[model samples]
Target: MKDSDSPRRRWWHVDPGGALGGLLLAVLSATPSLLPRAALFQGLITAVAFAVGYGVGTAAWLGIRRLVPMRSRPILWIAYGVLWLVAVGALSVLAVAWQNEVRRAVEMPPLDAVDLAGFLLGFLPVVVILIAVGKLNRRVFRALQRMSGTPVALLGTLTALIAGIAATVLVVMFGVDAVYKGLNGAPDAEAVEPSSEFRSAGAGSAIRWEDLGRHGSAFIGGGPTASEITALTGVEAKDPIRVYAGLESAETPEARAQLVVDELERTGAFDRSVLVVATTTGSGWLEAQTVDAIEYLHAGDTAIAAMQYAYTPSWVSFLFDPDAPVESARALFDAVEERWSRLPADDRPELIVYGLSLGAHGGQAVFDGLGDLRSRADGAMFVGSPNGSALWRTLQGARDPGSPVWQPVLADGREVRWISRAGDESLLPGPWSEPRVLYLQHATDPVTWLTPELIWSPPEWLDPSQRADDVSPEMRWIPVVTAVQVGIDMLGGEAVPARHGHNFGDVVTTGWREVAGDAGLDQAAVDRIQEEIEGYAPIQPYLE
Candidate 1:
């Protein structure tokens, strides 16, 4: 044995006990997963296996020390570093892959910045365990050397139990909140069939109150089904269709668009489809999508349970680089066009484009980006549009400033109906002469008045115009809170955003019948909607 003052003993020595402790810490960090039967089990098992392998590796290090008898320690440290890198890196990559696969299989919405926060924090236990175990192992080893017959086995067992309990407690306490929030964050159901068993479901006239609740608890909200939105639009089998929706604060166009796709599938009316791209500013419109879906909510299920997927490439961040969104929107449109392009080429599908707020601005961007592609589509509609008077701004750069070829008039000379809502002056008049545009105004919405955050933009064309000015900062808080209270009163487990909006959507949908009939759109299919809309009499101003 070397002298007590030797450099190896004092500073440069390797501690096998410390290595064992580090390995134990890794295994302990991964062990609790066995109880949950999570999809992460394979990755966790692999990590534990790596830890055991690392502990066994210490024997190789000892053998090297005895055989080579080298004074320099560089090789040993390098080997250890390489081992750690390979083992830890493999585990990390596997964990991410496993997580992504499982999440995708269920069509879980993309995790927002807030959702990942707990996963980010889960690293703390490993650091703490490594520190505690290192010190404890060193002290225990020193004691063994000083004593005659110290029970090393007992010491190792105690260390493992301590590490295991610490890791379990920390992971459980910190991880549970995040996991629950993540699972609950997405809208609940993919669809709801109200007529089946939910014939009598809804809150009583009395106002109840509560806040957040667990998944099945009588207090949460969800997204709506495609059927509900279609029912609300009241688009008869024959009339042209217009779709209006928004991107959630935490949802993307891709995710929300999935719901739209499902709606189209159910309607079987997408022989021609128009896309109204939006910039990110008016993402609040996604709430309208939720409302559309909610109209079909049932008593026992949450609203969002009916939603199939969330939209993606959310407009909020897409607004950062206006050009970037233009490119992406163009690509999306092109892909959609291509999907429909080959079907009966001679009889081309009539296509149009329009959007309002962020979508309107973004739609303009898409037009500018596409150049010739705009001509491919037939007509467009914009509400609360952002394009200026210039042709480039208005027509997505499709029409030239002085093009006589594009007539802006109808045969009978009524306006072409380029309806502008919410008083957006930036959406100037078309240079095209004589009735090429129509303006739809809501007196309450301040965005048209350029009021900053003072009013809520109407959630949908169907929402009561009176509610547009509901600018309470707490509007965001009310839905979640109201859902809980309303859900309990209704005897439902939890109310989703989609479910809560059901009444709103139902009122809007059923009311459309009157709107169509008054407009002389009365047909057999549209009678139900017209009667509902006419009955309310309250939503008239908003509809008009």
Candidate 2:
């Protein structure tokens, strides 16, 4: 009915401020979701559902207040307001304490400034909304009383409100999914290249030197070749060797591993270069940028060898057959280690390992445990490791009791360094010494932190002791709500800047300096290297 025809003013007319406050929250909560990879949408959806639920619950509470006798209406309102503050404050404090302890023990990012008062400040908006909603709810009962005499008017108003809510929900859900689809299939120039001669090889087939870098284009392969590397850095690139034995080349891992080693020997990799054995994701795609970082640090005296185990993209491979990484990783590493050992000890060059994302999961398969990893390779760097990866879990578990997961300063940063950002020296109890293990992770990367346990358990990151500043300080765990939210978090996990997500851009240069300190590359040299490596990314190939 039109306002003129209505018997009384609308429900929102009773408390305009309350309606405005709720509307503002709804907008804020949903706005970030419009961005490419904003994980905050998970919280936005939950807040909307919460508002709907609370609106219903508050209406019922207001109804009870009308039927029951109270000493004073003012006193009852004051009591409820006090209780809400107390409850919110208590929960925030307890959670912060737990989070602080864990972050300290693990050497994760520290949020010491997040005390009780600041914590409460974060929830100030929620408190305001609570007061507003309660007032609106009280007015709802009064509005009901005004409509009781007119049954036709009451039914029409109820129907309109329900329909409005449903329409809003549908719009939000459909809009989010549509945006996700568009981003997922966006085209890129590098992804258009076709494969070269690395597809199939016989038992004793020779390597195709000409077919390297997607048939000499240098724009279609994993890493820069010798000439490209030298040109970019002005350093005498020592053949910038890279060899990959495709899965189609041989029937078994043993054959593939041998093929990889054969190519390595052909390039004289075992003679004088530092050998880096990297494993690719399911798409058989390697991190050519990582290769560029190493070559710049080592002055092009490094050889990188890897083998294709699957032909699909990393995500598809991770979902369908996660174990493919484990199998191929173990096979390739075992084969390379066995052959590298055959060379004379004095002449044997240093061997390092690199694995990022799914490849990191597989590359970890070569070691039985941390002990084995320490004994086997000179150094190793695993970036954006998934929550399911065993090696990541082990070191994280071993960290001190109070450290956070995102940037744990494990065991005084002795043998291992878990880095989320630059300038992590404070996490180190002393100097950057020994075994030289570098783990690059970002607090915003859901792929690294999301797990089944998030539903049943409060994710360690939410403790407020050390989550990234980008994340909401008041984010709370609400069973299935948070699980669904984090599930969405995966979609835009890499949507962050190099310092924040799976996209670890220039930081790799810094990481290499720490892991390969023997290179004697100073800060200026590292900066120069970072710039050179970034230059190749524009034309770098994108694999399936």
Candidate 3:
């Protein structure tokens, strides 16, 4: 072949093999993930998948070229291009059908013509821009290599790469730190003095209202009132004790935990029938469903204590200050456990632990393992736990042979029971044990499934035979594409309707009842409390 016609001579242009690979993977990216994705998000996933596939294909082609001459007739190349286009069109149609199947499974509206247009419009520009950027970076690296002498070319390239990475890291670090500080320092509109002495930071409380921060104030102010609980349960109820220590409440985690214990004592929480150590999400947000359900179930004779560790949202904390939740949860639990342990075992109120999402991950960190968790608290309820939690992973891995990963049955459900919906507890066999640990996880919740391993391997939840009923049967796992799609799914996981994705909703009432082993709560009472909780508006709306 002439030099102009040689494949090596056209290295600057988009290689046919790479483009073909990119198209194939990009099309496959449209397949259903853990949750139904928005058109724009799907487009982004497709663009990312294309970039990854193109890189892999380019490398493979380069390797093959070294072993054999890359030569093809003009007609053969044209025919291959035509076949690729046909494949793309065929796969695109399948992609739409698969997405609609996922939507139907989740009770979401099907994708229409506008969605298709949106996906195409979103995908084309992003993919083209990413390709352009990749080419520009490659050209810049090549130019740098050429400028250096042949003897020092490798060293020059290494130095440039290191410098570029270091500069990027520094910029990101400074930018993130600035954003964190701004958020942490901003004044909360809801942090006002409470009129009732029953609440933390209220009339007679030592903790200041201004120190409660946004989420802390909301948590302290929210939940069913004594009258509301009495009306719903038809039994006179005591005012539920809610104690919180915000980030500004004390300087350190230890101090904050101690303050919470003090506030709990001041509110006579220990005298209540149930005392709960409720771990807060990154912004110190507590799920109303979890706490309210337990309170109403016990006829408002409950005390719930929580503390803030980070000012940012859970995702931000997961990325930047991953250890914050764990540390805070450990401190608060240890303090409460110590204080509760000192009281007369026969007279002391039942100690329970509760958390949702990142809060669940944090709450699990308080114990060494399953044995420790069982021994420490009377019962524990962790909702939408992230896959990274060690205790959760251990229990899940130790699940009985026949159980599914989405709703694992641990040890015949003697101690640990995984609840996906309202009546999942009924599916458990054998006698129920004290200190029951319940994990409330939806099959389609990406937060509970997304992990780094997803980039290379399929999770047990994707096993064909053991898949949960809520997950679409058509959903197939594709290595890197699956990881990206699921990660994106986490962004809007909680926005979906209750019982799907990360929104556990009122199903938590069942989880609380099972974990608490409240025999007094019949189906009617549970339904009433759930209904009341569902209708009640939150003092502050915060995402899990």
Candidate 4:
């Protein structure tokens, strides 16, 4: 109060109330997202801030008059303000950094403009509430001010500081623990160990499940009968394993598939197996057009699964046995076999499944469909999937009976080997196909941010028609368009509609690669596959 009161005299005020007000403000600010009445809360918070300033100022003035020898008062108060400001700045940085790291580890989507705006607005009330608390606690401020010159003041300050430090430490520790248990969806780190028996043909890296969560492909029915699996690889075709990867767009799968095919061909694996590119252009709104184009390069079929694409629960209806995961899985296998039986021998291909986000969950459905295909035909691959949400609940100890992870499954009639990547926070009722899983991951991928318990509620306002169109100016620059188009062409220009964003390319690559060895895919074979992917459209976007 004195600092603003007179220019002639060096003066200062120590408002113990300011500290209290600040504490209250911080607590309130921390809950911006949960606030029920934004406008009312903000006004009350601001009012409290002003009151805290007034109380702290008045208390400081009176305490100086009652105790401080006249001249030294201003200097002490100035020092107090400086120290507080530094402390506040340091705390702010810590909070922001922690939030960012937590977000990344759990596979949460990047913050949008709305999230940023909310953050900015959220802090005002916090500061105001803290200031208000300080203002109301006049007696507390006066007590501290009276002892300003004595060792008592130091002791009092130390006590307050200690309490604050303890509270801060507790908050941080609790936040981290909560996030670790709830948001970090990965299995216990101790649970993951290296496997020596399973090996990817060309990957120089160690296989880890976390990496599989980030990247892996599950193949569905094998390529179309018209396509020559033998031509793609010099080896005679054994079983046609179809591939599927579910993502918002098909770009990731297409790119990874081409890379895998090329690598396999160069390594001579293709000489033994034929690995043709294929895509599953789901018959959802956004999928049809994209799949039709993708068809030219990647061989794929467009299958519409009704509204289940948007309402994940609808997968229950498609399951072989809605009441039991194991039974459902077996039923799915029967359906696949039944379908294969009907197809002219040459038209039927083996099936594998791959997915990411929603697609990953859908992969679980495929596994359910072809329960024991590995023993009968080939294997499966799954990537970037959350176990409960997308992959139905089929594994042991399933918490959600309707979990998507179990949807694509077959009965345990035979063993199926699976390849996966790390940073996939997907939780399952149990481990993957026993004794046959390989996982991989990159250290920097943000998908690591996900925890099993963390739930992401998509905004209900998103309109299906507003989805980005390949020809739209906004989407023209996106590389994924070309990849999706590859899948679309595979489906003869049919497209899956979109309510939820789906990535077809990611599904294709991951699924096919898992069963690649069985097909004997290799480098030269991949080049031919790449040519087909590039040949789909009249103009090659990759060339540009």
Candidate 5:
């Protein structure tokens, strides 16, 4: 080691080990999420990113070492803090500009005090983690150094970098993968086994032996059967029903859509109340809460239909089922649209579209834009939408001029309303008539806001107190760190209480009531419907 005891030649020296330490720790912590994509490209991308951070951190440390006395811990820490501030200021502006570009807005947003606070808050955790990891790295290096017959500087640095990278891959392959496999829980039991045809829609319709899906998920009753419609909702309404047909790697897309349409005809659902055509993710799972809301609001007169596109869980679908969502949505919509258009206009039931998460992305795939949506469907509700959803992104770009991109008001809230909370329906100033839509997005849903730009820039939503009130103040936007934090946030997004986090729950009752645009939803009546929804156990049966 270059001696601090030496005079006149104490030039700033970069410790490659310390510089790369944080990157290694980050990969270690993020192994769980990254393990899903075990590919050469993923590893190369991660390694390149780590190398960049290593170079930047090395430069920062060397610069600080020259200016501050190494012996003075107080001054050194102060310098480190200032360096972080400088890093944030320089990087955050680029982030804001990128988000503006993504939003298709030309206006330049100036860096405010909140931006500074956000970066620093985000940086604090990162620094603590990196420092802790760096110390561990040193311990490992020292252990290696002791084992060596004679210390060699170049070999030691090379060994440490290699060890860090190897550790990352190893953790992903073993530790993270093992945990994910364990958490994958049991696959669909054979009991809820899927089938191609629809069964009877009578009251007290327990999932019979034949009712099991191809994938083993039972088609839990979305609404009471035809006989119970009067007793359950106290109205002469058609029984609400859902037929979820699971698609396997074994089946083609065409057959799946055909089976779904056939199920509609078999159960006599096409001739019933409002027909909702929804898209499911890999698991072919649908949110029961939203179905319950519609069933309650429509007084059991709704037919909610979703066909599973895959047998895998939604997270796995995200990594592997990028095209399955669009494919399934198109097939289902085309089949339903063809059938709906054939029927006389007045005689036909209203057609609507719905989805969430990957399902939401799939829902976006069926339409050209909001105009096409208006022409095709009576109403639609896409909840907890992903940031990359094409339709949602297009609407965001065409929103009201003065409204913030985060909460854009499309067409002055004429056809659509973006509601965060349950009663946020009150936020709408005017009435929504035909082609009504409601985009249910929680203010702090990382699934809806987190993007690739988070790597270098703080997202607009992460700025200051701009996030929803339920979000923690410490959930600030730090380069790289915020990305990891939010990645974890997505896993538990639905764990919070109702009306908060990514859990939309029965609030969708308000969404459906508004989207229906009928005076059928009286304040007192809707309140009772909401209570009925709550009485149904496990409000959110399937979390996206």
Candidate 6:
């Protein structure tokens, strides 16, 4: 057999062109992203970027080889190896510097020697394993191709590629389905029974406490008491009513929504000065701050109704069961609206819709247009709305030309407005209209901006002219790499400080006051409310 055909030589072969491409992207992957990433996450991003880069480089090289046949030399390989080592070593140091820059910008701790050690520990094995897998797959395909003449060989390779992809897709689908089922059925270890008289199923008329899933129970039982609010605001307050229905409470969305409405009716929720229809995240989790803010702003003269849609977290529900939120939000809103509309317009509570993250996506799905929105609800506040939201996209696409994409001015903020931080609502110099729709989205929020388009084209937010205040200036868009980085960023989006990433934090107080109409809150009162809510610890998701 010839040297090229030798098994040992084939097994050991490394493509110089591919290595160069991988190195280029691996270095670029270390640049600043939408959020600050730790050593482990950075390593994962680098490895994945390297793998993708290697594929692109390999494909390009193959195309070149087809056009002009050339053989590699030993001396050239030696020189290339030395150059590769120098480039990698130098770029790695730069990568660490870039990471530190991001950390400083985000007010996070700088990476140390231990972090570098951790990065290496996380990166090497993953890259090696990925390369090995790719080589093995290629070897199998080549072996099949070699079994017959040219025409048959081509057909065999095509057949193998199709079969492999189909098998992979099927395996992934089944595995993911099983995982979802397991998660849905799993009991929450942190779940505790409700003791609050104001909460659903807590010494109440109908819904059982046990039937309220972990998040459902937490939503109903948590938040400030009327006395707590009164103390903070220096005003008398009534107990805030919270009604929720878990997945186990009813089988279908319609049933659960009906149950929610029934609970609201029994609790005299419609009689309250302010009523909020809160669409919950995937695990039926409501942002404690979002609900608490409205209750405080209304001096506990508020009732919030929500229901569970899926058992998984927001991200999982986003990818797997995207329709659950849409379906559940529509059902709950329609049911509540039906009942509320039947009551005397002068006597009933002012209706408002609220949602965050996946909840926002679902809540926005309920409205067909601005007309539909104004016709149904008094006002709407959607925080960290996902890019996939059609209503959000429509409003944003038609935003005033001069306004930045991060926080667009829709119709000069006459009806719809977007805010990243407090006081943004007043930034737009236009007449404020009734039935206001406010989008509370941080400029750095991956949940609000990350999309498949990012894999190919640069988003307008990444443009220097349109970049947000919180986002690092060093952040640049790279095809595929930026997409992966931002996708990973979503995992820890809410872990950062308020007004950054996906964490809306205490800004919801201002947001609630703006959308729901401030009862009598002055700037001082709003500040006190923010301080009060800030003291409350974030509720941990039971499934998480």
Assess every candidate by TM-score. 0.30, 0.62, 0.88, 0.32, 0.66, 0.89
lDDT of 5 by residue, 302-333 (tens): 66667666545566567754888888889888
User: What is the lDDT for 129 in model 4?
Assistant: 52
Off by over 4 Å in 5: 1-216, 220-223, 226-232, 404-406, 517-522, 535-544
**What's the lDDT for all of these models?**
0.33, 0.62, 0.81, 0.32, 0.61, 0.82
lDDT by residue for model 4 (1-544), tens = 5654442331233344445444444433322110012233333433454454545555555555567665876886787678777756754554344334333333334444554356546545554555445444544555576767678876877689689889998797566434422422232243332221112211332222332211121111112232454455454433322222222212343333333333332333222222222212121111222222222223322221111121111122123223232232333334344434454545544333323333333445544333442444434444323335333233323323332221222232123322222112242334444223211211111121122232232211112332212211211111332222222222211111111112223223333443333233466664555444333323211000
Per-residue accuracy of model 2 over 261-350 as CA lDDT, tens digit each? 877766677865578888876566666567678876776677777776655556656775788888888888888898898888788977
Return the lDDT, model 3, position 526: 70
What order do you get sorting by TM-score, best first?
6, 3, 5, 2, 4, 1
Candidate 6 Cα errors over 4 Å, as ranges: 1-14, 55-72, 142-167, 177-187, 428-430, 518-525, 535-544
Best by lDDT: 6
Q: Give a tens-digit lDDT track for model 6, residues 342-460.
A: 99989999999998889999998998987899889999999999998999999999999989998898777889888888777678677878988889988888888899999999999
Q: Candidate 3, residues 70-133: lDDT per residue as tens digits?
A: 4745666788779887988887788789889988888889999999887888788887787777
The 10-residue segment of model 4 with minimum total lDDT is 304-313
RMSD of 1: 21.1
Among residues 3 or more apart in sequence or in different chains, the pairs in candidate 5 whose N, CA or C atoms overlap within 3 Å are 192-212, 192-213, 192-216, 193-212, 193-213, 194-213, 194-214, 282-310, 284-308
| Model 6 lDDT-worst window of ten | 535-544
